[model samples]
Target: MAGTNRILVIVTSVGEYEKAGYRTGLWLGELTHFYDVAEQAGFAMTIASIAGGHVPLDPESLAHDVLADLGTDKRYADREFMDKLTDTVPVADVDVEDFDAIYLTGGHGVMFDFHQSAALESLIARFHETGRIVSAVCHGPCGLLDVTLSGGEPLVRGKDVTGFSWPEEELARRADVVPYSLQDRLKQLGASYSTAEKPFATYVVEDGLLITGQNPGSAKAVAEAVVGRLR
Candidate 1:
């Protein structure tokens, strides 16, 4: 990839799930795994959030078991990498033309804020209309809920896609806490949604320039799919 190949990473700024009384933000592995893969592929990357400044991390995502399984301990300890989370560009300030791709990384926090940001929806729409790749993993697809194209059609309508599944949410015991089931919302928006029979498995789908991952475990696969398209 050339130096001009740039990617914009969208993370949730919602620090806590107010209704559930739990601290939540971006899932650490979701961002780190995707970032590591894209960066190593030679794409310059920028981190941005719904709200600028420090981004919260879902505490559970940093738990020992999760970190060990994801094999991201070194990234977790990277001071420079971790610093990027401390401050992020506000979505409103992002120039959609500068990025070749827009990646939405997820955590439960996204369920609350991602889908509600008009600025993000506009950015995604522009990226889509301009022939850039639009990708998301886990609850990050929540951001796609209301994006409308230039023709006023819902972006996900009639598109084959996948995201955090309803069964996965219920399995994680967050079904009631999350604002809504992401899979259900995607289906309601006319996206053809599907996922692995097993929760948290690596499952990625690409429909045109749109790429999506089923869960955090699918982050790298999703990034690779984007890289494949870009190449």
Candidate 2:
């Protein structure tokens, strides 16, 4: 009951597929920016994953060019951040209603595991029912695939949301790993998914308790929206 203001962040534990084989997990910078904004707003935060342990990271996203202008925060190396990823609670072990908000963080890895997990589906449903903020960014939104409200409609139906667009995925694709596009899936779920002109530009949509960010560039904006909800 205490720490009622804490936010629960979900990241994917699965790495790149054995066949496609490229590094992937939570987008490091995106998660850090989100935690920074949430913590600064005085909300405690905890990280969770489908498997409950260490999450992977995408190697390409760690390049100097990507981190140079914007994603360079050292929170990526912080002990606290590292601890959260390694010791994350399993989605099945946590009570979704304990937190005020749930933010799904993403990387290509999420496309591999976030969508098919029943544990995540249950959590999202509970969070939605409680009217708490339920958000995701980039491939993170893939996790929303199975979330159905009490009436059995896709939780995102009629909601204003955004995620990694198909074009962006094509632009960022590696030769080996190909992930399902979040943009397409969200539209299929009846979400009014919208975004900015390009993939990396910041874009976010807020519809009641649902919020989504388009890509890594939108991490800060996503955090700001979560903070806005709390206020």
Candidate 3:
């Protein structure tokens, strides 16, 4: 069981940078979905980000109602596991080959940095070339914008995928911080994206090495699908 498939979970590190900036990162449920399942499946997991330290969290995602009914019961009170999130592998310094698959977790903050990261783009490209599973959910799909296959085609082009929809983006704008809409950009990139009847409802699409989920609510299903493909 030496190399029983290592999973690299990448969380967004960007927070608001202007005056009175608050810490903002991944959705709490997004991280917990795969964390609970991957650990049980015996896959070694490493939490990482575009930068190496202090991953933030969207305040709304931590509401009692959101965590109370998720698949994992103890995700909220697990302090030790929560501490692991503090230390992250800088995408610029890590070797993608060390991981068997990569899962990008989402938050509104990802829109600020994930798409523009050259280091992350390179890592994902190598992950794709090696035939490793490259997965993401919600705003995390922003990271996919920079990934190009060996033929120079955007990895998501012609790939069936879904992400934070425009309607959901409008809703979040009414309630929280969101820099830009992932759905608009993905569509601009020529990705054939679709969604569920409700914005936050669970919806997933698996096209070759890419796997995507519609919103935070779909994180668990997306994680399950990634695990299924890896198996």
lDDT of each: 0.91, 0.82, 0.82
Better of 1 and 3 by TM-score: 1
Model 2 pairs in collision: none
1-231: candidate 3 lDDT, tens digit per residue: 524888888888876633235656678888898777777777789988888888888777777787775744476687888888788778898888789899988887888888889999889889988999999998889999978878989988888989889898777663345555677778888999899998788899889878999888888888788777777
Per-residue lDDT, model 2, residue 16, is 74
Candidate 1 residue-wise lDDT, 67-140, digit = tens: 87656777888899899999899999999878999999999999888989999999999999999999999999
C-alpha TM-scores of all predictions:
0.97, 0.92, 0.92
After TM-score superposition, the amount by which residue 59's alpha carbon in candidate 3 deviates from its true location, in angstroms, is: 1.1
Question: Which residue ranges in model 2 land beyond 4 Å of their true spot?
Answer: 1-4, 68-72, 174-176
Across 124-169, the per-residue lDDT of candidate 2 in tens digits comes to 8998898888999888889888888789799888888888887887
- Distance (Å) between predicted and true CA of 150, model 3? 2.8
Error of 2 at 168 (Å): 0.3
Q: What lDDT, from 0 to 1, does candidate 1 have?
A: 0.91
User: Per lDDT, what order, best first?
Assistant: 1, 3, 2
* Steric overlap count per candidate: 0, 0, 1
Number of the candidate with higher lDDT, 1 or 2: 1
